[model samples]
Target: MNSAEFRAVFRYIQALLIITQASLVLTDHREMLPPSPADINWLMHEWTPTVVRETNYSHRAIIPARNSQTRAAIAKVTTCDASAALTAQFFTEVEPAVRWLRSIYVV
Candidate 1:
């Protein structure tokens, strides 16, 4: 994704958060990622920990965490860089991912 595409996706995500009636299943099935860790960081920056803390809607982000560009993403959330604690978990499979969402129960 280019910067504009990234920003568009970011805005879309932010828009999704505006609706508070349901859960969000965010599946990033992209075969590749935009060539910038800075964009990833910007995205994380845009979606703040306060949003995670405040929103009642649950989200399941099915991202390829350990072995991809999202490795940086995984590290960012896992470390909670500068208190940017995104409320997401990484999963390579669906069963455990579902279990995790159920386990959290954001509602």
Candidate 2:
């Protein structure tokens, strides 16, 4: 998606979080194609920091990897960019993600 579309979706999620007083953002990226560079740049450099400054949102991205190399790469990228309030992680399964969100008391 383009920047406008991405921003619209993000804003929708923010509005939903504000209305429900929620803190967890569960993004299911299973079976989806890899993100474009623009998307990655916006999310890691822009959206994440914005969320960190504006809210206590913990983002859990469920991204199924095809192999160990992919998993390692995903882990490296996510862990390197994560923050205290923005607990970004890529989970291969939904159960573990649910458990983590619960552990954080944000589910």
Candidate 3:
């Protein structure tokens, strides 16, 4: 997707994040190109912080590693997660990923 398309999607995700106490960002950039530095920076500076601050509980991502390109994008998001508390991790499947995210809430 192009920058504008990326921004629009991110905005929608960010808005959903803002209204929820805890949430998941399901980013499967399957056929799409890996995000640009501008996209990564937008997540770092804008999207992540906004979501982290908005959500009262944990926020996580389930970005399946469909390819090396997707893995790289997950890595960037994972790094950003360290500071934002929006934990982004890659998985090959959905079930285990969602299970892990739910496990985070258990006391």
Name every residue pair that clashes in candidate 1.
none
Residue-level lDDT of model 3, residues 1-107, one tens digit each, is: 78899889878776666666346555555556677888888877777777667665354545555577756865676677534565556666767777777777644
- State residue 15's C-alpha deviation in candidate 3, in Å: 1.1
lDDT per model, in order?
A: 0.57, 0.62, 0.66
- Candidates 1 and 3: which is better by TM-score? 3
lDDT string for model 1 (1-107, tens) is: 68778667656665667674445555544454533666666646555454455554355556564446556564564455533334566677777877777776654
Listed in order, each prediction's TM-score against the native is 0.60, 0.64, 0.72
lDDT of 2 by residue, 1-107 (tens): 55577667767876777677677867655544445556655666676667666765666555566655444434444654545455565677888888877787824
lDDT of model 2 at residue 38? 65
Candidates ranked by lDDT, best first?
A: 3, 2, 1
Stronger candidate by lDDT (2 vs 3)? 3
Candidate 3 runs further than 4 Å off:
81-84, 104-107
For model 1, the stretches where C-alpha displacement exceeds 4 angstroms are: 21-30, 57-62, 65-67, 82-87
- Output the number of the lDDT-best candidate: 3
Give, for candidate 1, the lowest lDDT window spanning 10 residues.
77-86
Residue 70, candidate 3: alpha-carbon lDDT: 57
Highest TM-score scorer:
3
Count of clashing residue pairs in every prediction: 0, 0, 0
